[model samples]
Target: MDDLFDDILNLEEQYYKEGYDEGYKDGAEAGRIEGRSVGMKTGFEKFLEAGRLQGKAIVWQSRLPSQQESSTSAGNSQQETVQTVPSPTSQDGKDSEPRRLPPLSSNPRLEKNITMLYGILEPGTLSTKNDDESVNDFDSRLKGAQSRVKMIERAIGEGAGDKGSANRNRQQAQKNENIEDIGRIPQRTDVVMGTV
Candidate 1:
């Protein structure tokens, strides 16, 4: 009986270690897969965001020529001022050029996108963050994106409603125009009654 008890105890210990090892391996594999999937998803989102920002930049670039022309016109006025009066001197006693205020940037969405793009493009910026921290960051970004999308949807809906009303108004105007044209036609006042 003593020998049997000792054998049972040894068997129990062996099985327990085997079970722990297997569980640990399985958990590690699952963790690795989860981490990889999350990383890929985050990377793809960043890629899309970068592309969006690039598109915005392109739009801004296309508007640059117009902006420059306006600025040139403004510059002519500035040149008149320069000729009449010297700009205020700084503490260093050098002739300081007049500061030209930048053009008013009206698009908040574009600004935000550019700011986010800068953050994304910063060098080695995300290397120190761990997986859990990254997951939290992703959650925050997703929430912000969702809100932006909702706002866009609302704007689109309102725009569609406005277009529908405009279409109806246009159709009504056309109908009125047709009626006016019919009323302007000449009526026959002299009908011949000699034919049977």
Candidate 2:
């Protein structure tokens, strides 16, 4: 009895140890997945920011060539020349002049596009119309799919009902045959009562 008790305790301890190890392993894997997802989110945000900055830089740079030519036109009036200032560049290829760009947060159009894109990517988000006709088109397609499903279900239900009716008839016929074969049963009372 003493040895059996010790053996059971040892088995219980081993079971708990194995359970703990598995739980720890699962937890570590879950933690790693969560960490990677967060890292991807952070990286995406940085990429968007860098992309925005690069876009701004390129747009401003494009206007420079035209503005420089217009400023050096030398055909404008003296007052125009005085008003127009030539922006100077630093020795290191960086612009010394500062230009103000519209804030990314203030662009309503871009904000709306971003919101729509996010909605498209994430489920349960608010739906927006890409266009007047496209929205209706999607709704129409959805309705078509639903109608097809309903038709299929009705066909299936009818098929199953037919099978059930046939089975019930078969069973009833079998029961009647068995009763008829068992004896010279006098069913005249019920038969006559039904006829009357």
Candidate 3:
């Protein structure tokens, strides 16, 4: 019958469509794998760029003391002389030097090995030599750090409170279990359904 033949054609088309969809899904998954690899490469590139900048900044800082010393001897502005570092010239001639300022000495080790510690931390801001100019961005960052410390302290306090509450809850739950008559418990159901 013609009806039977149409049904067979319909079934064949359905199977073909299913196979197409499965192939599409497989291709999409393969595309996703390639996308993930590209994303990872991009992330790694960004990390490397940040690290390079940090290194440049550190190098700039290391050379600050000599500049400071020169300025002091010359009776010139101390901060001013330190600001005039030459262009960075790496071994590769790809200069990353004087352009970048050293990160500051926030480390505890500054008391121990002054030279070694100074080698690590450099003045990030060239303009931040005096308390006047240094007070701008440095002030904000210091405030931010202070706020972060407070937040951490608050979090620790909150965590302790939550632990105490959870212990109380657990004890209550255990008490309920102990007091309940488990052997002769009755089965009950509450149903609220409109559509049957």
Candidate 3, residue 86: the lDDT equals 43
The C-alpha lDDT values of all candidates are 0.57, 0.49, 0.50
Off by over 4 Å in 1: 9-13, 64-196
Candidate 2 — number of clashing residue pairs? 0
lDDT score for residue 153 of model 1 = 29
What is the TM-score (0 to 1) of candidate 1? 0.36
Stretches > 4 Å off in candidate 2? 65-196
Error of 3 at 75 (Å): 24
Q: Every model's Cα RMSD, please?
A: 21.1, 28.6, 21.0
lDDT of 2 by residue, 1-196 (tens): 3576787769988999999999999999999999889967864664454344334334433334344446446435444435333345456545434343322333344333333333333323313444667555544543443343334324334322456777988898887686557677566554655454
Worst 10 residues of 3 by lDDT: 110-119
lDDT per residue, candidate 1, 1-196, as tens digits?
3676787779988999999999999999999999989978877776566456445344443334455567678878877655333356555546566554343344566445534543443335434355778756655654555454344324334322466777988898887686568668676668667754
lDDT of 2 at 36: 81
Query: What would the per-residue lDDT of candidate 3 be over residues 101-192, giving only the tens digit for each residue?
Result: 34333433322233432332234532334355554554454444334333432433432245677798889888668545646566645655
TM-score for each prediction?
0.36, 0.31, 0.32
